[model samples]
Target: MSSPVTPSLTYRSPPGPLHATLLAGTVPLFLGALLSDIAYYNSYQIQWSNFASWLIAGGLLFCGLALVFALVNLVRAPKKAGRPLVYFLLLLVMFVLGLVNAFEHAKDGWAVMPAGLVLSVVVTLLACVTAWMGLNLRSGGPA
Candidate 1:
């Protein structure tokens, strides 16, 4: 009787393009939430009670979902790991910081926050723009 042959046990690498784009998609989505946090970081002087919390919470939820989806696709098909990974990591940090601000805001009731309200506008805008661009890339042609 003849012996059966076996395939190579080494792991093969997939094309990098797919992972690149997946990373790219994470950007705009993360920004969507991050930007919202910035917009509402400190409305206490503006004296809008709980408004920042509401906006940030909602934004985070949406962005978080989008980020997860993007990451998942990258994992499943790493060819999409574009620049969005860097952007996503940065935005993720901003989001965490925003949440911290939210906690502080709750105690102080919008007392300019430790970092002040400016963070809200800047971060929020950046997040929005980045997330938008990232998502837009996903629907484009030619990878």
Candidate 2:
């Protein structure tokens, strides 16, 4: 009598180094932008707003690249019913919000405040969530 055969399992590969780097880069840049926005709100310094704008631009660049990578992974994934899809969606939302935040930051003077600060907060949180999901979640299944 032979022992029962076990089925093979397939696991989703973790993100490549470049993708991981891009995801990791977004969080700090967005967080820095939020901090700068808060500083500008409190101190009314134009320089702080400039800093926030630059930081938001960097965050958007990194996020857009990461979103592309996530999209590619989602497409290439053999099974897309779980974390991969969710990860891609989260990244998509983060990128869109970041873009909006960047546009808000582009406004001049008092117009940049309030809305810019609020958008910075929202975009930062979304970046954190997307980075966490992209880095931690792995989808797997039977081959």
Candidate 3:
């Protein structure tokens, strides 16, 4: 009689509690940071440039925290487990873009606001994707 085949194992390990926490926390943390910055701008004589700075700072902080978590998890994982270095590099790229966008927003008028908005969206999406990858990587097995 024929039998069903099972998948083979590789150098992957299931994500642990820390992975779960980091994965789930990243989005909310970013959103909260962004919202806080927005709310801070509600005062009189609001300076969008300042708001941009706060937003950039918030995004960078989130990325930094996420990178640290990924590094720690990767170190603890089995040698066969895939490294999350790509995510780390991507986060760094987002950080640089965020800084650039912040500078654009600091310029007079809203001429570059559209570009800044696009950068913000991209950064947020990247953060989510990176976190999701971390969450799933926890259950890794041999390639």
**Tens-digit lDDT track for model 3 on 26-117?**
56645543443444334322464455556566666655665676666556654523435555566567667656756765665545455655
Model 2 ranges off by over 4 Å: 1-10, 141-143
For model 1, residues 1-143, the per-residue Cα lDDT tens digits are 99999854433333245433443443443344334435545332333435555555555555555556555545654344444454456456656765665554465544645453554555566565655455444411233
Candidate 2 per-residue lDDT, tens place, 41-83, comes to 9999899999999999999899989989998998998788688
Selected candidate, larger lDDT, 1 vs 3: 3
Shift in Å, residue 78, candidate 3:
3.5
Deviation of model 2 at 104, angstroms: 0.6
lDDT of 1 at 12: 30
Angstrom error at residue 78, model 1: 3.0
Q: Cα lDDT of all candidates, in order?
A: 0.49, 0.88, 0.57
Residue-level error in angstroms, candidate 2, position 3: 7.9
Ranking by lDDT: 2, 3, 1
Cα lDDT, model 3, residue 64: 63
Model 1 reaches what TM-score against the true structure?
A: 0.54
